[model samples]
Each structure stands twice: as structure tokens, then as C-alpha cells.
Target chain A: MRVFITDTTLRKGMQSASLELTYEKRKELFFLLSSTGIHELEVGVPAHSEEERDYIKYLARSQHGDKVIVWNRANIRDVEASLECSVKKLEIAIPVSDFMIKEKLNKDRDYIVRLLKEIIPYVKSKKLYLSVGFEDVSRADREFVIKLLECIREEGADRVRLSDTVGVLNPLQTNELVKTASSFLDVEVHFHNDFGMATANSITAFLSGAKYINASLLGLGERCGITPLEEVVFYLQLIQGVHTGINVKRLYEIVNYFIDMTNIHLAPNKPLIGKNAFTNKSSIHIDGLTKSKRTYLPFDPEVVGSKAALAFGLYSEKANKLCKK
Target chain B: MRVFITDTTLRKGMQSASLELTYEKRKELFFLLSSTGIHELEVGVPAHSEEERDYIKYLARSQHGDKVIVWNRANIRDVEASLECSVKKLEIAIPVSDFMIKEKLNKDRDYIVRLLKEIIPYVKSKKLYLSVGFEDVSRADREFVIKLLECIREEGADRVRLSDTVGVLNPLQTNELVKTASSFLDVEVHFHNDFGMATANSITAFLSGAKYINASLLGLGERCGITPLEEVVFYLQLIQGVHTGINVKRLYEIVNYFIDMTNIHLAPNKPLIGKNAFTNKSSIHIDGLTKSKRTYLPFDPEVVGSKAALAFGLYSEKANKLCKK
Candidate 1:
């Protein structure tokens, strides 16, 4: 099945300390990301700042307006801010776990149900595609999560986002979570890479029937970041046979441009877009690549606008081969 | 169930072009890794160089000899080299995929079975714990892989390593592969991270009853590297309830030390050991941390000898809170 993507490079990515993009730069980023034909872009949190609101207003009225999704808190002010931007799609996030409800909001489950009762229909009345995001749902009581899903679905919410806010869910757990969440409403998954399982969990969530997968340009977000957009897209195309309409070849260019704009240097060994992702050093691996690219390379580097190279080093057998010749 | 780990930091890690650890540095890394109580260390490929052979001899005769496993190719010369090191344990790697067997080795399946028949008994006769590594097994024909497993088991091979040399298998496929392999002999899993799924695949392999999981520090290896040792160790302890007897607290320190010794700087968002793994900048997340750390953290950062901190940025609400106070 085809999967939809909601890349949050402009929202969750900007929330991290490392990246700080101005409105003009963010506008540039929007076009670059949009060029990939991503299904949606969580453009910005309208309530975050006047500049954020202005940017949301610009994107909400742009040619790609249908592809822009404004993020909001489960409050009237946040809703009003997005409404002012004339955004056609929005996600209202609320803490779902009991610990978060009590500590962060000083409320109970009844309060959440009441908040959803008001927010879900209010957004629906405005004819916006509303997604009720369950923040920290991975740690929420399973029965309560189901109850919340029913609550939102009953109130006309179009989707429910299973946010692994703390990055605690493994693939197996994600499968069960998505399976349960999808039975009620369209499912979107947002994961943190805290334990380095976000890519895996996102893929599992999709296989288990998640419709929308939330990711970022380079998995750039809170703490260890989120699922990487390039990873999910390439994986689906090459391995799962699920073709996302995204332009796979533009991935490296987009990620490189983002890195250049943000001055974030990825680890050379970072998967997919890293400098060394396709570079082979060992003689054994080089030999394998010499015979058949499939022997050492996962997918052709050209699929993502990259190329493979061999670096002669401590393990180079090229010298021996040349000597024999 | 307690899971087993065979870290290949000095072997596969060193094989990469970026890292060139001298024998002395490897000795230092050995002690650092050994202190974590890792089940085994694939120290190095003894047949690669004279220095490698000497280092293998030193480790094979040391106090941690039983914990060391020398790597070899599926050749008598490689086996004899390991024997000269007096290594009590060794793994003979042979290409198993049709493409690799045909192109890399210019041999067929029958040749593989023949090689295993001769080599398995030869290694077994030496009273060494032998693991038959099926390189590129992820792309091998399923029936042929099973047939080879039967051949190795009949020849008295103690373990079979399912090596995802091209990093193609996802978690579900890994589960099925490991489940099938474990029935014939003890199972070890080694995966590359080309698709950014090795950590997930390795964890799934363990959950599917594979006894041994191979990893490298920082996931360092060929191409985009292998499954990371830290990710697997932390994931099992915090998420899966599989307590590997590893000192989790030493993870950051060890990674930092390795980085200094190798001059490799990881992405700040690198999970577990990156500079920003526990740093929160977003106002909402910092507020959550203020109320309760669990609201924003996957696990206590101190578990990995790190601490959480708040950095004021574009999204900081701390300024408003302080003004109200």
C-alpha cells in the first residue's frame, strides 16, 4: 500500500536548539521540501511566534496551501492562531499519558476528554482536516488511549497521530499500537530516535497499517530527533515495493541544502545521506563491489543521487590485484 | 531472556577507511570494551596481516582469550592462520548469496557445501568453538540457505551467523530469517545499516531466538556501518526487559573515548552518545522536563552516564515563566 508522508522539518526540526531558520530561509526550505512531492509539510506552529504565524499565513495561502499543516496546542488561542492563518489542515497536540496529564497540564483524563470534545468539533466545524495528536501515547495506558481514540473519532476528527514523544516504542510494540489506533481513525505516526529505533518503528507502523508517517529532513528534532524522511521513502521504494510519489533522486540534494543552510554536519557514517554511506574501504567489500554492486551495496547510489567509490586503505586488495596483473 | 552480544569494534570497525587503530590502541579499546562485560569480542581478522595475526596471538593467550574470536575466510590458509594465533574461537566467513558466490568467489552452491564440509570438521577437530558466517545471506536463496545450514550442522558447526551484508532485510524479514536459522544451530546475527534498520533488525533477530547479536561501537563498519552496540544494549535494557550484563553507564564515556582516539565526530543527534541526545531546547519539552523528566525523556540519561539540560532558544518559555515569577 502507498504511504503518505508529513515531514516536520520546519516545525519539530526548528524546535531543536541546533537549527534556527529565519522566515525567509524557512520559505526557501518549504519550496525545497515541496519539490520532493511530500504529501504534507507540518509547516510551523502558528502559536509559537508572530514570525511563525506570518510564515503559516504565507504557506496557508500559497500554491501548495493544501499541502501545509499547521501545528497547534489543544487550546482555543492556538486554534484561533491557525484559523487566522486560514490553514486547511491542522494537528492539535495534547499529552496522553497519565504522568504527562498530571505533571505537565495538572489535569486528569476527564479533562483530556473534555478538551477533545471541544477542540475536535470546533476544528471540524471550520472544515479543516483535523488530526488529534496523542503526545507520549507510547507510554499512555493502552485502554485509555483506545478510549481517547473513540472520543476523538466520535467528535469528527479525521485522524489520530500516535506520537512516540519520548522515543520509547520498539517495532513490535509500534505494530500493536498502530494496529489498535488504525481501527478507529486514520493513523499518523511520529517517533523520536532516542534509542535509534525511529526508522524501524516508522516502517513497522506503516506495515501494520499506519497511513501517514511523520519524519524530518535528516531526522532532525528533539533529543535524538525523529524518523528520517529519506530513509522511510527509500526503504519503501527499494524494499517494501510501496511507492511514495516523492522524487527519490532529489533526496541527497535537499538534505545537503538543508545541512548547508543550517550548518549541521552529519556524521560521515549517517545512513543514506552521509558522506560515506556508499563508500567502501575494505578489500573484501571492494572485491564484492567489483564483481557485483549488489554484493556490497544495498541499493544503487544513483537511486538517491549518490555514487559508490572505493578508497584504498589498510585493507586494500587492489594493490595485490594490480601486482598480479 | 538474556541476549548475547559479539561487538566487532576492533574488527569490522577498524576495517573501515575512517578508522585506523594501531595495535596498541586496539589493546586499549579491548580493555575498555571488555570492562562492559560484553559476551564476546570479534577482535580482528587474523589472516589479513602479520600485525593482525600477532595481536590475535596476544589476545588468545591473555586472560580474555576465551572471550576473543578471530575472524577468517572460508579457506584453509585463513583457518591455519587463526590456528597459529591459538585462538580458541573463530568464525569462517563465506559468501552464501548466488550473486556473491558466482561473482565474488567464482563458485557455486555445491562448492560452498564442499568447503563447509571440509572446513567445519577441520575447525571442529581443533577443539575450537566454530561459527560459520553466511556472508550476504540476506540476498541468498532461502532454500539454499537452509540446505547449507543443514550441511554445516551435520558437519558439527556450533553456530551460524546470518549476515545481512547488503542491509536489505527489514525487521519482519529478519524475524523469519532468524527463526528459521535457530532451528538448525545456535544463531548469530550481523547486519549493515544501509537502510537505517540494522539496530531494529538486530533487536528483532534477538527477539526471534537468535542467541548472538553482532555490533560495533557507534555502528562503525563498511558503508553506513553495522548495528550500533549502544543502541542495542540500551534498547534491550530499557524497552525489551532483556538485561545484557553490560555497564550501560560507561557507554557515553566509551564512545567519547573512541571518537577522540579515532578523530570521528558523531552527529549531535546520534542516539545514546551524541551531544544533543538529552539536550532539550523547545519550550514545551523543557516545561515537561521541569514537571517530570519522564514526560520528555525515553530513559534516564544518567543510565548512560549523561544528563539532561535546557538550552534557551527561539522556543524557550522559560523567559516568560521567569518574568511572571
Candidate 2:
């Protein structure tokens, strides 16, 4: 029930093409995220700019309760910058697969591991809560993944995060990877929603034994975005009976603030925070729901600061009549 | 890899409040559905009105190549009307849960089973492909569900549809129940997206062994709508390696037609059909994707008649620069 939300909006969400939160806006957003019970923030890459580095440093020092985590590559300079910024948590992201390391980073598997071993101790020397991220872990070989985790654990890294960098995993695969990895070390899941499986994958990871999940508000990240915080919070609390320490009612408010600030339209069908998540439009459903809300609802909408609306359309006269009455 | 699409927009989607497709519009819609490669069309309830019954008959006769199924309650009158309309497939809907049977239908479990037994033969006598619908099947007791399936199977029902009437199922439960039920009968899944689990649950059911799925175009139905046809089709074909009989390239045309005919706006983030489903917004993703679309895409969007867009706002310049270079 001790759920940790690692907000990747500054890093991953910035990848959302239309979203442009300035450095100052990013700092302001952290305060808003903190108020929503987010325990950690994956602020941004320190390698981006001196301004970005200074802002990350400012947030690391100035933010009161929230753990300011810096996302960085396997390079020592990025790790050192993150350390210099005094980030409480340093996520050292290393591409694990042949495709990413060879194609993207132009490095071999051994070099990636060697790079992590070299940088992790430097991070540990700074006494930072080190979470080594295996980028594109889903596509990485299982044995290689195990080897990397073992190496990281031996290097005194605090934990390892399984990143579904490409969002290619299904729930079953997610469970297998998380469970297998958890047996070796404390594992966290950082899922991408490229296939719309981010939230589901994250929940499966949690249920399968992963303790920490990486989430961004509204599933906002690069490509399809990361795991949605609202969805993870709702499922963990309602279905799994786990407490996330989230003020459930404040979810809508926080999401709305981000929508307004980012000028991104919240899709009405987006899970949890979307307009249609809690609304009932069918007459048969409304009639049954009117008798007992449980007849049509998994959980009360009010629990998530959502109100049920009567969707008026061709087949919803009963709901319309009930609403009118 | 053979996939089947059952459009339930008329039957289930019409149940939404303020959604009224006139008889003529309904017929036009039926024709439109038939033009698509959709395998089955669940036309409206035959017992709803004289007009509904006549329309069902007309569609059953005219909609060649597409199996016209009629929704009916587990009652003699409804079954007789469905038969009179010559619907080759009959989905006899009955509340399977104690809550629905007792509260909604004011009947006991025994009475419900008896009703099914009595109606099953009447429909089978007409040589109709019968699919018994267990409304609220997710909430029903597992043992009772097994028993109901057994009775339906014994009574010669061709298939059994497990309706997540209240949308109470998570992926695990959906898999377990569908797997168990599929062991007894040809299982079809009908899901409501009340908790954003409809598409996930439908896919889970298919993975668990269910052969048939019910979906509405654009996810148009009651409450949060049914399983999105586009999501199911895309995931099945792209991920599960299943061949849905749909003309993949024509999907966009069909979606556009539905949007125009219904005047329902497709949310920008809707999977497959939505404008943003294939749009790249992140600089990292755009950089990689522009080089090779496969870098971030699970499958080619053009396969489903969708083209990826470069969504630009705050994240535009860097991503655009990377793409242009």
C-alpha cells in the first residue's frame, strides 16, 4: 500500500509534442504535483541545458517533502550533474537491448553494463537513492536483464526499474518480467503506453510484486505516454485494496490544473480523469443503475472526485427521464 | 488468425440516453454496417416495438453476407418475436447474478435457468445460432456461472457471452472467468468500459480462450461504451497475430462515416481511430520515429487507415529540428 508515484512529465511528458511547460512552469508544476501526494518527481535530464540543470538543482534543494529525482543517461557526466544538483534520487538509465545499445547508443552490452558499474558507484558515493533503469527492458533478453540487475545490486544500487521504453509489453509479459526481476532485486516498473498498456502493465507489475511504479499525470509521456497516475491510483485502491496515500478527490483538480497549464485538451475518454469514465449513457444501464449504482459501476465515481453524468443519445431516454424527474 | 467483428451499436449503443436513431437511420446504419467486412450485426431488440421488429426482419433479409443477430430477453414472447423476424443468430439476454435476477427481473436463479431452458429449444428449433447472454456475468458467483453455462450448453446454445454488465472485472478476473467458461462453451465477451477495462478485458478474454467478442464502432454504446472495435481489431491483428476479417485500410473510412453519421466526436486520444493515437509529440520519439516509424510504433498505422501526425506545440521545435535534419 506504500505506493510511490514517480512523475516523469518533465522528462517523458515533455515528449508529448504539443506540451511545452517552461523551466519555470516545470518548477511550478512540481509544487502542484507535490500537493497531489506525488512522492517523487523525475524532474528532467541535467544534460539538457545549464538552465535545466540549475532548475533541477533548485527543485532538489527547494522542494520540501517530495523526493526530487533526476533522469539521466548512463554517462558519468549526467550522473555527476545530477549528484551536483543534490537530487535525492538518481535514475541511471542504461539501454539494455542490442537494438537500443547498438543502434541508438552505438555501444555493446558489456560497455552498457561497464558504464552502469562505473557510474552507479559514483552515484552511490554521493549517497543518492540510486534506481538503475534498464531502458527498453521488455525487448532485452531475460538473461541479460537478470545479469544487469545482479550487477547493479552488487554495485550497491538501492533498486532497479524495469522500463518498458517502447511500450511493447502485455500484462502477462509485464508480470513475468517484474516477478522474475523482483526475485533477484527489489524492482520497480516504468511502463510506456505506446500500445495503451501502460497503466495495465504497471498494475500487473505491482500485483506481481514490483513495489514502485513510474507514472505521469494523464499518462503523459513520450509517444503514447507513461503509466497514468489516476488509473494506477484508482485500480490499486479500488481493486487491489491497496492505499496509495493519494487524496483521491484531489485527482481531478490536479489533472485539470495540468490540462489548463499545458493547454492540452484532456480527452473525454481518457481513463479515470476523462469525462466519460464515470458517465452512464444507456437506458438499460441507467435503469439498473438507478436501482443500485453498483449495478453499473465498479466503484463510486465520487471516490475519484468524478460525478456520473447521463449521456443523452438515441438509446438513453430512461436516463434522461430519470434525470428530468 | 481469423477475426470477427460484431457491431452492437444499434442494439447496445441505442440504449444510451439522448441517442435516437430513427427507423430509417437505423436501416441505413444497418446497410452501412453490412458494407463493412464486419461479420455480425446485433440489430436492436425485436420486442421493443412493432417498428423494431419490422426493422429486424428487413435487415435480416436485406443485409446479405452479414449475420443479423437480434437481442432478446429470456422470455417466450421475445424469443418468438426474434424468430418471426428471421434473425439467424439470437442473443438471449438474461441476468445471471443474484442481484440482477432478484432486483431487476424479480426472479430467482432457478427461474432464470428455467427460462433459458424453455427458450433455448424454441430458438434451436428455428435452427438459429443461439448465444445466451449472461448480463452482469462478472458479478455472478463463479460456481453459478459454471452451472448456467452447463445448462446453456446442455440446452444446445451455440455460444455464451459473458457481459461485464457493471464493468466490475479486472484483467485477472476476466481471464480466469473467460478461461473457465470457455472450457465449457464457445465464449464471446461483451464488456462495458465503466472502469476503463472494457478493451483490456475483451483482449484478456480472447487471450484466455474466448473466440468471439462484441464491440461497438468508436466504442459507442451505453455508459462508457463497449469494447472499442478499432482497439480490438488493431490489437488482435497487430499484437496477437489474429486476422480480424475487417478490411484494415477501410477502418478509417468506416470510423469517419460513423463519426459523421452519429455526430459523435472521436476523442483525440482514442486508440487507432483517434487523431492522436499515431501522432508523435515527444522530441525523443519524433527523432527516432522519423528515422524509422518502427522505432516507436507497434504496427503501421496505415494498416488501420490511420496516418501518424507530428503533433506540435511546446515540444515541436526540437523534435521538428531533429526530424528535418
Candidate 3:
């Protein structure tokens, strides 16, 4: 599977919970995730804190296996901070929609385009991989998004990340957007789970020709976090027949470690790594699942380093009783 | 604006982690939810236990305002049990796809039709409001769904429920399915949160043409639960201008009570009632939000008895300093 894992534990996951990590802790996490085979580490915005910038620089110098990506606004100051940290990849996030830009940034589409054109060359001068992020791209005018992609490509950006900033796009919209954007440039998908369409949207983007996806461990990020890495990895490899290059056996270990380090509880219903993702409760479902897993399961739980659990409650007899039989 | 609330706490919420309520507890919850202005309540399956049958019958007799719905399989035995329990509304659930019917039931399409035709009349004979649930309808062939809807409608089913049984639908698919089904009959949507598309799918279903939706408190159910009642209520009222006789200000109380009673930890990122749903984590976001609540919030959190939270981590200094401010 040609898969890429982006660890958002430092960014989105921490924001989702009540916990806060120091600069040293973030550096530790970046090193750990990089060593654990994650392809990308979304280190927090370098402009946000001098300490964070120093930590990103430390990790960039120390960790050699994975790309260190620093998130920033479409501003020269943010771009310069990221470059000073020696990060290989910089994500310049510019809100594309009139609603977001007008309301959030008090800027118009013309200003957005100008901002991207200005930042792209500055990052390229530092020899950093530039991934232009179109914030709230789903709500953005389709023509605007297409134009943004073209401008980013023309400006020599390595890739463009289509962000469903508010998590509004469904799979069909995701497919349409990604397909249109992919025609002009290498597309990446960054989905939030606000309305819980993140993973599905990401998969649809992949199917529509996006080469990279922005995901957090356990779908962690602001709001509902980003698309879950584990879920996207599973779907890409098992269902869509895509190559994600994920070490499936180590997925659970990574989840547990992140959970332990962050103290954020995974939603029981979270796909792949959630407590009950593979658990069967109904007697009928358990019976069929036990007879043959395909009767109830979409993908083998073992493929993601999870075991099917048959728990007893309102729906079925005790799993131990079934085992005894 | 016209809206309705259907609480599936008994049917779907029971599927949450380690949640097993006695017959009396279910009845108590029914009364509590009914008193809180829920228009409908999905009581447990009468086919499961004699106590369930007695409790459902008692609740149906006593709870005069709320529509008491008993969930059942499209089988003679299940329908008979629902009738015996005195449920006024019968939700007859049946597999609609060739994959589900053949793999799960080991039955052909002809057999399923025969079974539904046989049971629908018996259900209608009791003067019960019948809603046929097409399980996994998203994966089912559209032609098959249309045929089954026609058959059930002719047999006196009051409405049709399109179930995304495995939560495999995206918003586009949900809109398409609901729109297609609406062309034939009044449609209700029952979405699972399996792939994290439940809320978006529910919204799209509402936008497309669905009049009713199945929801559980806190989005609790087997594999990620159904669409969350709070989210649907909020979105319909705030965004879509639809009113659901729900006392929106009391939503948090009901959600918290259910969570505490069940001992299930609510994910901070859960929509509507989640801790982070109204939180502003980014500093820039906080600045815009302070300028105008509309800058960051899609809808007022107070509409659902929630206040915006300012949390810290990756996004901004203003968000981190909200508590201090």
C-alpha cells in the first residue's frame, strides 16, 4: 500500500483534549512518531511560539526518517519562522471561501491569491516542500479552488492540500473537488470530522486521485480532529486496493502509545482503533460472525492489529459460552 | 419551521459501552425523554424478552403523548411480538441488498418479498403505524430498494426508513438515496456512525427530502450508534430553519444524564454536545470569534444549552487564555 501517515498528536489531538504539552513533550512525540514509521509529522505552527519553533528545529535536525511539516498562515512571517526551524515541508493555509476569508480573515479572494503567490516563492527559496492548504475549500467557490490549485502549481508548490475546514464535504463532493484539483496539481486531502465525514471524504479523495492525505492519530485535531490515519490506512489498503505503506501490525501499538502519552480517550466507536470497532454484540451477528467473519465484518480486524470481540448484553449470549461450544 | 424528535436511546443508545438497562430503566428513560418533548421513542425489541414486551406495553399504555415505536425484524414472530406489546408504531427492519439478504439471511429476494407481504398485513391489522426499515439500503441496489418500498407501501407501511446499516454512506450518497426513496414514499433516515458520516448523512437526508430521522442520545448504538439526536436537532433548527418540538435548551441535560447513567465517556470532539463542539482553539479563530460569534460558530451553542469553550493546545494564545480572560 502506498500509504502516508501524518501524526497530528502534537497539533489536533492535543487541542481535542484538556491536556497541554510543553515544547519538550512535543519534540519527544515528534521523534517517537517519526521512528514509528509515520511518514509525516505535522509539528505545530512555528510562529505560535518561539519555544515551539526551537523544538521544531530540534526535531528537524534530530529526526531523519520522516518529513517534518510546520503549519502556518499564508503570511511571510509564518513562512520565515517555519524555514528558520529547518522544516522540510511547510503548509501555507489560506482560507479560500468568501465566508471564511471575509468573516475570519476580513480579506477577499484577490487578497488570498496574492498572499499565496507571495509565500510560495519564499518557501521555495528555503528549499522546503510547499503544500498549499485551501482552508474551507468545500464551501469555497469551485472555480476559486480550481484557480487556487492552478496558482499553487504555477508558483511551484510541491502539492496542494484541500482542507474541508468545517467538515462539510461528503464523499461525492470530496471526489468532485479532488478530481478537479488533481487535474491541475498533486492534491492532498485534509479533512476535519466536524460532521463526521473526515475519513470517508479522505478515502474518496484518494479514489479521486489525491496522492496524499492529512490525518491525525485517532482522528485528533481541532473540532473532531483530522481524518483518522488508522481508518484511512485500512480502507485504502483493504477496500480500495491502494498502497499506503503502513505497518499494520504496529498500528495498535502506535494508538496505545499516543493515547498513553496524551491521555486522550479514543471514542469507543472510532473506526479501526476504537474500543468497539471490531466487537460484535447481537447474538445473530455474533453467531454469523463466528461461523464466518465475512458474514458481519467488512474487513478482517486482524489486518489492523485488532481482534474481534463478542460481548454479551442485550443482543447476545456471553462470548465465553459461544467459545465453550 | 417544522421538525420532530425521535429518541432511539432504548434501541440505539443501549449499544454503547457496557450499557444494559433493565426493562424498568428503559421505561423510566422513555418517560424522561417524553417529558423533555421528544416526539417519538424507539422502545426495545419485544422479540428479545418477555419483560421487554410487558414494559413496552405498559409504556405505550401510560405514555400518551409520545409515539411508542417497537423495532422488529420483517418476520411473523417479531411482528406478532410487537403487536402483543401494544406498540402503536412498528419499525419492521429487513435486509434490502442481495449481499445482506443472501449472506446474512441465506434467503433469496423472492423469499424476502413473500415474508414482508405476509407480515405487513398482520401488522396493519393491529392498526399500528408501520415503518419499514430497509437495512443497508445504501449498499442495496437502487432498483431493489424501489421495488421493496413499493411492496411495503402497498401493504400499508406508513413510511420507509433508509438505513445505512454499516455506516458506509457519504453525504452525496445519503442525499441521492433519500431523494430517490422520497420520489416513491415518505422517507426517514437511520444512519450508523461507522465511518463517521452519520451526522453529515443525516443532514443531507434532511436536505434531500427525508421528513423523519432515527437518532439516539449521544449517538450511541452498535458500531458507532445512529445519528445523534442533539446534532440533528441543532442543525435542523439553526442551519436549515426546521423546528423539532425539542426544548433545545434542555439538550445538554438529557445528554449528560444518559452519559452519566450509562457510564460512557463522551468524546470531547463529539458534535453538538461534545466538549469541543463550541470550543475555539486557534488564536486567529478566537480573535475573529470575539469580533463576531458568527465569525467562528456555525450556530449559537446556547441554542442547544451549550456555551462556547476556549481551550488551549495547538491553535492560538487567545483560545488558551479564554479561561483566564
TM-score of chain B of each: 0.96, 0.94, 0.93
lDDT of 3 by residue, B184-261 (tens): 888888987766667767776776788887898878777656688877776666655677887767766877787777
- Residues B1-325 of candidate 1: C-alpha lDDT, one tens digit per residue: 8888999998899766567778899888988998888889999887888988898888878887789998899999999989899888989999999889998989888999999999999999999999999999988999999999999999999899999998888887888999999999999999999888899898889988898999999999888899999999988887777978888877668878888888886898899888888888788887788788877888788777779876666777773474467
Q: Order the candidates by TM-score, highest first.
A: 1, 2, 3
For residue B163, give model 2's deviation from the true position in Å: 1.5
TM-scores of all candidate predictions against the true structure:
0.97, 0.93, 0.88
Docking class of 3: acceptable
Error of 2 at A143 (Å): 2.8
Q: How does each model score on lDDT? A: 0.87, 0.76, 0.75
Top lDDT model: 1
- The segments of candidate 2 whose C-alpha lies over 4 angstroms from its true place after superposition are A63-66, A320-325, B1-3, B16-36, B63-66, B309-320, B323-325
Q: Provide the TM-score of the second chain in candidate 3.
A: 0.93
> Top model by DockQ, which number?
1
What is the per-residue lDDT of model 2 for residues A208-312, given as tens digits with 9 covering 90 to 100? 889888887777765566777777887777867887877767766878777877767655555666566667776666777777767777777877666776677
- CAPRI category for model 1: medium
Q: Which residue pairs collide in model 1, if any?
A: none
The sequence of per-residue lDDT tens digits that candidate 1 reaches over residues A7-122 is 99988988775788888998988988888889999988888878888888888788888899988999999999899898899899999999899999999999999999988888
